[model samples]
Target chain A: MKKRSALIIIFTLIVGLSGLSSKTFAETAKNNYRLYCSQCHGLTGNGEGIDKPTMGVAPKIHNNAEEMIKLKDADIYTVTAQGGASVTKSALMPPWEGVMSEAEIKDMVKYLRELCNCTEK
Target chain B: MKMTKLTCLILFSLALTLPVRIAAAGDGKTIIEKNNCGTCHKMEGPAAKTFAEALSRKAPDLFYAGSKFQEEFLVEFSQKPYQIRPAGTLYLNHVKTVDGVDRIQDPPLCASRLSKEDAVLASKYLMTLKDPDMKIGVYKPGASFFKIGAKMIFTKSVACIGCHQVKKRGKIVGGTSGSSLYNAGSRLNGDWLSSYIRNPHYWDPMSPMPKWDLGEHAWMQLTNYIMEMKE
Candidate 1:
């Protein structure tokens, strides 16, 4: 019984640490999103930002789950890190690799999934 | 009190000149305020409050006008207003879809042309409203060697090309969401450009552009690259 209790405590600690790490990462990504992407993409990921009208082409509406679901995770990552021009999309989406960390970019991808309410295929 | 005639003459002369100096210096400020230029422009302080307010702003922020504009250009522009932003200050308000393609309407007219005296006075007053924190001395003038690297930074690193027009291969190419930077070198002061790049929020709180954490070297190089773009 003593050994079983020790194992349970260890298990709880591991789970709690992992949860904290993910929550911290998610918060960082959300802050970065507000600072960088929210301007053109919008605070709610609706793509109806102040710059939307000025853009010759409308920004992708991230909240549209149907459209977001059609895109692969790799495609979204490429567009976010390398910019829209990398995939022959609009040149307006600037590459963010230099400005953000690899970890942050990955987390932002997760956040984007959350915004779309969809998961990677 | 017994005063020498020379002392009295000097005192009288000084009083006469003081009023003339004050009139010359204060005329511009009075003229600007009298015209109600603030109705369309923010002559001082931060930008609009909300996104909706930002979109509805009729004119550009004039808080940094003293730093941003060339005096000669301002004077002439005040007398004979011309289109600066091809899509107007709020492009969304002026955009219309035609055959599935977005078309920008003609820019709105500026307030009626001011008389020559008023234009000059207004320009002089406007030029005095500069941002002191805008560091212009860090940038060396006419340094065009960094064009190759700066172009990469502008296009790939920061994606400024997405919204601003820049000259490439002897042709203009870029997004039109922001004003075309093709003539920025001639149109805007390098100092104002650097300050704007450093912190756009300082001038306009509601500006849609994000705050970039670019170091001094990066921003100065970018400024040089922008200033080199003329015509």
Candidate 2:
């Protein structure tokens, strides 16, 4: 009876820990996107927003998965942090590396892949 | 007998001259360049005479303005400027390199900074850009093709109708990204229109319209269609 109870408790702990970790990751991803990616890239990633009018270059719609697939995690992250010019895209996209934390950038890269349904290696 | 002959002659001459007096008179080409139209727009081809290629701009070219805009409409739009056509503004920054990237060191300058006289003169010059090369095409005016064409422009192609006002069942609808197309036919030229649609960035460096890969028929058709927009 004691061994069975102990085993049950251990299994519950593992399940609880896994659930919590996933929840934390999700929350972190949401925060990263809202803070860094939404300005020019847009909340829905449609490339249309208040920023779209004034932007010298229109940001790509992240909803297009095929286009997103061509880009890499490092490329997206560098673009997010370094601005569009760094990636040789548009100066309108400002770099966010100094503005955001390293972990936050990584979180954003993952967030982009998720939002666009892009595969990341 | 002499007085009766003189009166008859005067009456005939006055009748013939009335139509000419009623018509609008102005030299559009002289008006454009004198007013510094080149600052925002590039009507000429690549700068060959100059030592360096002028920084590429974003405003659409006016090289074909004479061929595009009708005279009365040009005078009217010049006097009362409004964002009528809804084509996307041509302000996308040209990427100097293959990656299509550059650093924006400063914000763009607004015309508000200019004096009132300068603004009026600039507006006057912009009114004169009619493309001389635009000969009327074989397409019938007010044909079903134009409606079908405008529909395609709004839907399948650049999706310009999302931001611009195109005639829809006689009602105008769309966002104001650039000017409205309700008056584009009355205000633009065919050759300039074709060149602009082919490459919007060639004229204006700061425009947001993407360089779409369109074919010759579509380009000519769209240009011809837009030139007929008179109010």
Q: Top model by TM-score, which number?
A: 1
Give the runs in model 2 whose Cα sits over 4 Å from its true position: A1-119, B1-64, B84-146, B169-171, B190-195, B199-207, B213-230
- Sort candidate 2 into its docking category: incorrect
Roughly what TM-score does model 2 have, to 2 decimal places? 0.42
**For this target, which candidate reaches the highest DockQ against the unseen true structure?**
1
Model 2 lDDT tens row, B1-231: 999999999999998986644331233344455655567656775322111122244354555445445555545445554434222222123111112222122223322233343434434444444434333453444544455775575444545543455665788665344456776765655455667666654444223344455576676667666666656
Candidate 2 chain B minimal-lDDT segment of 10 residues: B89-98
User: Per-residue lDDT of B50-128 in model 1, one digit per residue for the tens?
Assistant: 4456666888888878888878878887889876666677666675545534556676877848889888888887887
Q: List the residue pairs that clash in candidate 1.
A: none
Q: Give one digit per residue, the lDDT tens place, for model 1 in A38-115.
A: 546765677765456556667887777988999888888888888776798876786666555578888888888999
What TM-score against the true fold does each predicted structure earn?
A: 0.65, 0.42
Model 2 score (lDDT): 0.52
